[model samples]
Target: EDQVTQSPEALRLQEGESSSLNCSYTVSGLRGLFWYRQDPGKGPEFLFTLYSAGEEKEKERLKATLTKKESFLHITAPKPEDSATYLCAVQRGSNDYKLSFGAGTTVTVRA
Candidate 1:
């Protein structure tokens, strides 16, 4: 069984403040780790996919890093528009279509 836990269920930040969200997980056979951003009424938007430890990906003001036991989503100088629920999900194996997801960490950036 694969399990994911995201810390700091909710976050409040000033417009230019930067912070990192943590996603811890345990899986039998790790295939890939994924990061997503979801708004109030929309489906989750894909952000990054890390296939191995020490891997990283970046887009705009967000960066995603992967390790053997956890992943981190770093927000750099976030703006009000960056406010969203960040979700972390994991795939168990190479051919697995099912994903285990965390409850998500809701980030609110105030301008």
Candidate 2:
């Protein structure tokens, strides 16, 4: 069965600390993997899309990389403002715009 799972459901980081979040998934007929950042009370903001293994994407302090079975979101020198819930999702087969999202990793950066 196709599924997505994230570890360390919640994390607390001192300002300027760096960390990496994990997203493990298994899907049949894989299509794409996506990452998003969601602020409190707001919808998720698109971060990256990985189409194949060994693909990587970066924006600001966040870098996302994918492998055949999992993906990782690495946060570098995070600030307090970077606190948010990072989500991992996947689309398989002909799902079109549909995505299966993992539980998400909530990160808090405190000064």
Give lDDT per model, in order: 0.95, 0.93
Question: Where is model 1 poorest over a 10-residue stretch in terms of lDDT?
Answer: 90-99
RMSD of each: 1.0, 1.2
What's each prediction's TM-score?
0.96, 0.94
Pick by TM-score: which candidate is best?
Answer: 1
Q: List the residue pairs that clash in candidate 1.
A: none
The regions of model 1 sitting more than 4 angstroms off are none
The residue-by-residue lDDT of candidate 1 on 70-93, one tens digit each, is 999999999999999999999988
| Each candidate structure's count of clashing pairs | 0, 0
In model 2, the clashing pairs are none
The best candidate by lDDT is 1
Prediction 1 global C-alpha lDDT: 0.95
